[model samples]
Target chain A: MNIVVIDYGMGNIRSIQSSLLYLGVKSVIVSSDRNDILKADKIILPGVGAFGEAVREIKKRNLEKHLAEAVLKDGKPILGICLGMQLLGLSSEEGGFNKGLNFVNGVVTKLYGEGIKIPHVGFNQIQVNENSRLYNGLNSEPDFYFTHSFKMTSEDDIGASHCVYGSRFVASFENNNVAGVQFHPELSQNNGLRLLKNFIERF
Target chain B: MLRKRIIFTLIHSDGYFMQSRNFRLQKVGNLLWLEKNYKFQHISFSLDELIILDATRNQKNLSQFASIVSGVVNDVFIPVAAGGGIRSLADADLLFKSGADKIVLNSLQYENPLIVRELVEKYGSQSIIASVDYKSTAEGHLVYVNDGSKKIEYSLKEYLTYLEDLGVGEIYLNSIDKDGTGFGYDLETILNVKDLLSIPLIIAGGAGNEKHLLEGLKTDGIAAVATANLFNFIGDGLPNARNHIISLGENIANWNANS
Candidate 1:
């Protein structure tokens, strides 16, 4: 299968490529090319850094349109990680009010609670949704590495899995072929690898 | 719940990985030797994060260190933070392109505040880690930079506040006296500064075994515990240590080994 990792000139793409290769994926291409993304069997959107800059880059490369067509219209399975996950939502409050890809019904904002740390960095256990394809074959409560200041919040039932740092927030969400994870599964060890494998096979 | 982390720090000088004692470097082996001994690909499964610092004292090369980092973290599936001579955005870009999820800054945090601000503005505070190396003295904890050669003006507490003000995501506090001693983490020092900052704290420099790891993790307000001792947790030492730490009922991430 052709696995295309969207490269919008941000975040670590090497680790995701390396992880796929380790999982016996023979063809994994990192590209921002529209054709490459459209032609792929599956897509992985990985990102880090500021939300405003990431959204601006995506729009600059016309990735916003291409991704919408591929994932929404074409019904191709796409997995967004970290800021990539936030990008799939409606908007983010990182720098200022910035719009996202809006694949999932959600909004991104800074995590707030009494006496909780900002940029919650470390591995934390996630309460996986029973119907989550990305969390299949994992423990009831699996751990994934998360590093972010802003988190996605939603009232819609997008099959969201929740994790509590200071308060409960969306850890991951799946809606048919469209999925997004707040944590970095590529950096989450065995459970991460397993999730990637599930996305490749199940999704 | 947000779980604590166990970080393994690799100190690289020139082309070889070194075993550091009180900030003094002793060459251990090359990349081949490191792979043969540590089996990082397999052992990385036991770790929450990996930090590789280019501790090359003289004539530091960014490209060379980036190559080593890229090569070592090939199949290792963990958040890797790399630094040691990152002066410009291009240098930070090189490491990010190479495979670093976050950039570690020590001297630059003090020497250049503009670049630090720019990096924070560009990559957000979470992508930058402020590494503080200090030694307990007769007067107080004295901060050091430039690979522990010179002492800075700020005390440990004052320096941490400076890093926080600079918008660094995390603080990597290492004790020069306790480093590589295998004695355990300087808990007293850690306690002194743990509650002072709002950002995540990663304490380094004196973990000898799994028990030390447990002690550090068990402490309140510590986000992570880091160790750069190359020989202490060799082979299955890390895996065993992690298993022991988990067995102690500490709140850590658990993965299915069979998966």
Candidate 2:
């Protein structure tokens, strides 16, 4: 399968690439080239950094337009992980009010609740939706590694899996061909591998 | 629900991985020996996170360490946090490119507050971990840096507050006295300072067995427990401990390793 990992010059791209390699994917490309991303069978948006800076880098590299065209227009399946997932939302409150790629219907905001630690790090159980294509072949409640302060919430009927830290937040969302996970599936072991396989084969 | 974590720390020095005791290092073996003994590709399934720290006391090599990180992370699907001698954005960038999901900082959190601020601004707090090594004294817990060679003025509590204000993502508290002793964690010290933390806390040092790991994980306010004792957790040791911990009802991530 032709899998292209969108690189905006941030986050651990190597780990994602290594995970794909371990999964026996023969054609995984980490590139920012417009044509490479547009022609891929699937695209993985992987990021680890501030939303504003990440969005800025994406815009600077002109990946925003191509990504919109590839995922929104052509209906290619896209998987956004961690900061990449947050970048799919309408906006984020981190690093001031920053706009996202708006591929999914949501707003990223700081996690607000009493007695919860900031940057909620570690393995947390997620309530996976039964019909979620991203969670196919997984257990009812799967655990994924998450390390983020800002979380996504939506008013629309976006199929979201919920995880509670201080409050309920969108851990992963499925909206047609565009899917985003707040956790790092590449680092989440077997459950993660299963989820990524579902995205690659079932999506 | 956010579950607790069991982190495995690997101490790399020069071209060999070392076993540390009371902040003193003893060379264990090279990367080949490590791969043969630990087989991280299999053991990583039992861990929630992996932290690799370069503890070379003299003439630390950044590129070589990065290469080792890159080599070991292959096929080992788990969050890897690498640090040691990361002084610049380029160094952090190199580690990220090499496969580090998060960068752990020690001396720079004090020596270069501005760079820490820049990192926080660029990567956000969740991508940076502040590692504080301390030794308990008559006055209180005294913070140490530079591989525990230099002692800083701030007490453990004061230093943690400083780190929090500096906007680090998490705090890794390691006890210099209890390190590698197998006596279990210094739970008293953790309880004393647990209330002062606003970020996630990872406690390290003196974990020699599964019971010790369980004791650390069962404590309230402790987010994760880390062990760097390689010889103690070799072969199927880690997987067995993980199964035991899960059977004991501690909430940790479970996955089918055979799958």
Per-candidate RMSD, Å? 1.0, 1.1
Q: CA lDDT, every prediction? A: 0.92, 0.91
Interface RMSD, candidates in the order listed:
1.2, 1.5
Q: Write the per-residue lDDT of candidate 1 for residues A1-203, one digit (tens) a residue.
A: 88999999887789999989989998999999999999999999989889999988998999999998999999999999999999999999989999999998899888888898888999888988887888888888888999989889898999999999888999999989988899998899999999999989998
Candidate of highest DockQ: 1
Per-residue lDDT over B71-109 for candidate 1, one digit per residue giving the tens place of the 0 to 100 score: 899989999999999999999999999999999999999
Candidate 2, position B43, lDDT:
92
Off by over 4 Å in 1: none
Model 1 error, position B234 (Å): 1.2
lDDT of 2 by residue, A21-85 (tens): 77788899989999999889999999888888898899999998999999999999999999999
Clashes of 2: 0
